[model samples]
Target: MTKFFNSAMAALLISSTSIFAQVENDTEKPNSNPPISIETMAGSRGVMYQLIINKKFQSIPLGFFSVTNAAATWEKEMTPDIMTQAHLTYTLFKGLDISSGMQYTPVYGFRSVAGLIYSYVSPQMLIIVNPKVDLADDLAAESLALIEYRPKINDKLNFYSRLQGMYGFIPKSGIHNRSYIMLRAGLGYKEFAFGAASNIDWYGPIKHNENNFGVFVSALLF
Candidate 1:
């Protein structure tokens, strides 16, 4: 299952890049928004990388989006560990969508998921809230939320910051599942951004906690 999961992720990423290239090479432009973005951080405790894709079809009514998140600790610790999650969403309304995807965590392994997402975007801020359920033996409910703010400090530089968190638990047995919170604050120059980042994670019924703090760099990859 692990091998299959890894392979699936590689294929998904590769296909996304291929589609991006094809779109650029062809005269048919889909949307003005960048199709992909990437972020990486190296903290005192570990290193983290994340990729997000918001690809919209010109012919389709709405858009489809995907998110991939991962992190690794310097000491190879499992607490502040590596994880990945991806979701595909179809827009239902202006700021609401139905989404489903898969996620892999150290504690939960890999699980199939289905959910809903609502997003709000403006000139200086972006917000997203997602609620989902795990289609597993335990039957867990999960939620993730994110907020990003970028205000113009000047024409060439903009202030950047983001807050994101996730939590999940079983409804029947009331057993705790997993949770994490992440924060990033930096300065962006057009497609490039750099600054401080932090991650806090909690796992399982015992609610063990882990912390990581460090610097980060991000870019918009078209």
Candidate 2:
């Protein structure tokens, strides 16, 4: 099942790229919009297939073990081009969940990540702090802090918001500072979720280099 899903995701990405190329060729000049560029911009789309198997101990108030595998692809336009990461997450917890995972990418090598997530303040909010250690040369370790808030709006709908900040030891090539701000807003209905997010990256003294925003729609099959 995992193999099949991975193959399907690869095919989808190829098709999306082909379509983008055709559109670029058909148009003499591309629009100079935020997302649309005169030159072809690198982008990728893939299905994240995940499988989880877990067992909970009856004696403990909260004790569980689970295994999860996921695959994702990422691409950059002019600099730091194509890459893919696939990994499995092993989780263990008593009262609070502690997860450790490794992401392997052809270009970036393996990145080890450990995180602790806990919920408080009415159980509607979660705080996550993840420190990542990158094995690839020239890249340094980074820390990501995320605060997620989910509130039940009604029986049929809910709202979710996430704020994320990142700081890296070795700054990225093009960008000066490694700090960035991200905001996400989404609505969930049953198994369907739709969201849009914007990322503002700070670079140089002026703090203006590149900003990205995108929208996504997702559905859960099971």
Candidate 3:
């Protein structure tokens, strides 16, 4: 076991160095086309795959693990000079998670729903405080909002700072129902990001706030 652990550590170190070097090189280039975006994260005893695809026909998006115990959604993006795509995610995990509006190009404008809009001036800073809304008879989470601040660290390196506040409310719950707040921040080069993510949920299924924090790396699978 010791030998295997040593080998794994060495391999991870080598891979990190390689990625850092490549990112530097890409930053030095004059201009590079925007890469496709697919977010994948692995850590905290679980893994998440958030692929970006959109279609008019209704069908489930498929990927690794090949099971429905996970969260998955597909989005459609088609641009006629200025293109905008939206995704609505409803699942068994967190009830309903609808992402904010984003702009893929500079030709059009950006829109947001629920809580407050982040920012219209900087285009990179967004702050929101959501109010609870009805999802169903038994399904609901205390109104929650998240602020995502993205900054370009370098030509090839981008840093993402995300903070979310959640107040869980189950109108049909029998007992303890707690609120949760999560912070996920990371740095990405090209289409990959690595960093620390933590989640704390109080008074829910376990009656106590569960704590989960760890290193996570996500890749663009699209």
Candidate 4:
């Protein structure tokens, strides 16, 4: 199990490096700007591992609740902006909020796993909800709520915390459905972040393979 997680983490790092290389830097030039961005997220639950790719487009704005349809209105209000996203999840076990599998096991498949995400991004906070349905033998409808907050601390460092949870409506299970909540809190230094991640699931308050406390790292690949 230790070897399995190590291999997964190594793969995540390798992919991150390649993505960082391919992505053109966005330094806020005086000319054209692209709204597309990519982010990398990886974590472990003892032996179970998860790697996620988060892609989002922010240029196309949804003026649903804004006073004006102008894209600049979001910049002024310091509130949420409407945007679309695609989330890809790969995991060794389905215990985390990201996967829809019913039990804890070694089998992990990416066959029919994908999510559609829409987000409202504000200056100090972000909210995202994803809708997903798997139609294969592993059937599930995964609904998720994700939130992030960054508080003012200093010039180079800030306090940050994120709450992400999901419920799996697997009527195929007949009775028990799957659900999990993952919370992470720590300090952010520029583009790099290290935080403590804690998660709970319906399988029990805690599982044997679950790590009570884990260190998680994330980076804006773009």
Whole-model lDDT per candidate = 0.68, 0.40, 0.39, 0.41
Worst 10 residues of 2 by lDDT: 17-26
lDDT accuracy of residue 62 in candidate 3:
16
lDDT at 137, model 3: 43
Q: What is the lDDT of residue 211 in candidate 1?
A: 85
**Over all chains combined, what TM-score does candidate 1 have?**
0.78
Residue 199's lDDT in candidate 3: 59
- Model 1 spans with C-alpha error above 4 angstroms: 1-34, 61-63, 76-80
Residue pairs that clash (backbone atoms under 3 angstroms), model 4? none
Badly placed stretches (over 4 Å) of model 2 are 1-123, 135-139, 171-179, 202-208, 219-222
Name the candidate that leads on TM-score: 1
Count of clashes, each model: 0, 0, 6, 0
Please tell me which model should have the higher lDDT, number 2 or number 4: 4
For this target, which candidate reaches the highest lDDT against the unseen true structure?
A: 1
Residues 128-170 of candidate 4 have per-residue lDDT tens digits of 5555666568565555556677765888887778776555455
TM-score of decoy 2: 0.46
Residues 1-222 of candidate 2: C-alpha lDDT, one tens digit per residue: 223423443342233200000111222332211111011111133222222222333444333322232323354334331222222323343213454455443444566644442222223554444445555556554454556566789987878666655544443553333445556678867545568765555543344445656654444332
- Candidate 3 clashes between residue pairs 3 or more apart in a chain or in different chains: 53-75, 54-75, 54-76, 118-126, 118-127, 178-203
lDDT, residue 214, model 3:
66
In candidate 1, how many Å is residue 151 off?
1.0
User: Which sequence of candidate numbers ranks them by TM-score, best first?
Assistant: 1, 4, 2, 3
